[model samples]
Target: MDDGKMVRALVRAALGRALRCDPDRLPIGLKEEGGVLTLQGEVPDIAAKRRALKEAAAVAEVRRVADQLHVKPAVRMGDGAIRDHLRDALIAECAFQECAVRVRDRGTLESVRTPIGTVRGTIDVSVDDGVVTLDGSVPSLVHKRLAGALAWWIPGSRDVANALEIAPPEEDNDDQITEAIRAAHERDPLVDAVAIGVRTQSSVATLYGTATSEEQKAAAERDAWCTLGVDDVVSQIQVVPPTAPTRETRTA
Candidate 1:
């Protein structure tokens, strides 16, 4: 064998080692001339194609590895099976793996609601042509990220696309505050029913009414401050005297 043939053999051997396959098992033919190596072979899979090229490049004496490896297709997954596999993958993810996250038989949606007042409603998990798409909304930024993370774990997914919105917490309006104040007044022992008027503006409030005692005045002020959206307080509350006396004229 000439020096060129020896160099080609060394290249093939190094590649076979990296691939963990027998050097003789690979039916790769090599052509070498003027330090350039030409490779011709049919690889069983894409892994073999990569291994062959890598081995050739690692050869110090060889200037180039010309790859001509044809790849063969192996097993094919059915559409329904692929979808089922992806569903299982999604379920295994830490975010959605728990018993709380459950998928419907139709696979149209998944729902997860936690005890922390966070809600995830109607997550649509679907895969088409190896691409996975998740559509849903959560109550906060944390749950939104959780939903996306869950989608990525799906098997056979070429790519995952998430379309989710975080819903803001609902706000209580003036009517609710008024109702709460009325309820508080009914519960308090010091408050005179229907005698106090609680006036509000954009949740900021002012208590301008009369009360029988100083304690009642303080309680009314406390109630007004606790109401939601009350920014500033203007207490014009007067404490009425329990007893009234007749007017008498006196010389000073």
Candidate 2:
């Protein structure tokens, strides 16, 4: 086989091994050309689909991954059934136990209500077809992401629209916001906080620095965007390969 064909074959084999443990994703189809991998076939939920893409992208020499996988629940369920399943999952999670999970069908609100006197915050869940929408407020960005992940994990969920707001403890100044962004970046293993400069002005966070890859750049932006009180994020970050020489080094 030619070099191109060999590379593609190697990528396929690597991806297959990566997903071998997950029976639900074992049937996913993979095709690679010019280092770009395309995923086909169906998975049970959005989480499975994301896992497949992540596994494919981790293969050596993979430049990009295109997701064409569909979400097909093992058993067909109505909107009501899907909502109940999501509610049970949310209430069982320690992080979400204090939050209410409401379900809506299409644009119409469903009758499933969390009791009248519940004091905890509200998290509204809407289901249309298999797609889910999460709205309301959470104490932190972590909770918002957790809620969305839970919703996406449901068997029948095709996608998730997470609109959950993060309730800031108090008003934060630009400096505090910048510090928060920096802390978030430092906490994330994928980001190199030392290389990234964070600044906030008028509730907008701006990031400046060079990242080793597009994924790292995006992770930095996400960290800034998720910081409390950050109204917007302006990413001035550049993607530079690890082997590339820096201008400062060249001048020195």
Candidate 3:
């Protein structure tokens, strides 16, 4: 009825339109005052949280969106355990072993890994409660996305703010998404990188080819979605056991 209420209503309507659902149907909470909006709730996944923030921020009446939305982690863990696990995952990756990686503990930044070669970049990792924030610079978008994915995979990471920047910024497109997916698959032990093929158009990745097990097929698809820039994924991966040599169907 008043100006503030009207603005709030408009913002809700915009979010409803963007999400293609009734604002009431959306589980997230929205609070707006003096044009600053804060979103809070548990979303199903990272993608939904990101979509909510993007759509809410586009509202004409909203100044900025404070993201308090959290993804319910699959496994619960303490901050210390999460920090240790995340550090290990990053260090194990050959791409990141050359980068200076540090994790924040207590009041100081603790060194996790010293660069093996010339310093490629710096990666600062910090965890608060269940939220993980990645900052600093990386050499490529693939590295950035990989780091984000690794963070999200952590059992206690309720939210990940991937603020890592790429030095000598490269153009990001569907091709980059495809490359990242392939790289992820190569690193994933469950997936046969050569067996699962990726093709992307407009950020939608179509994964076709043959997989040894149903788990492998599913893992390959999940890897595609975890990569940055992948909006949607269509899994055309056929499960072919090692004994079954017959080719089923594949997407071109």
- For all predicted structures, in order, the TM-scores are 0.29, 0.43, 0.77
lDDT of each: 0.56, 0.69, 0.83
> Worst ten-residue run, lDDT, model 3?
243-252
Candidates 2 and 3 compared: the better one by TM-score is 3
**Model 2 lDDT-worst window of ten:** 110-119
Candidate 2 lDDT (Cα, 0 to 1):
0.69
lDDT of 2 at 3: 62
Predictions ranked by lDDT, top down?
3, 2, 1
lDDT score at residue 108, model 3, on the 0-100 scale? 93
Against the hidden true structure, what lDDT does model 3 obtain? Answer: 0.83
lDDT of 3 by residue, 38-109 (tens): 888887766566667777777777788888999877788998899899999999888897789999999699
Better of 2 and 3 by lDDT: 3
lDDT per residue for candidate 2 within 134-230, as digits (tens), equals 8888776656655665664466766566788777643446877787677667656789999999888987788999999999997787666445456
Over 4 Å off, model 1: 75-252
The better-scoring model by lDDT among 1 and 2 is: 2
lDDT over C-alpha atoms for residue 89 of model 2 = 74
Name the candidate, 1 or 2, with the larger TM-score value: 2
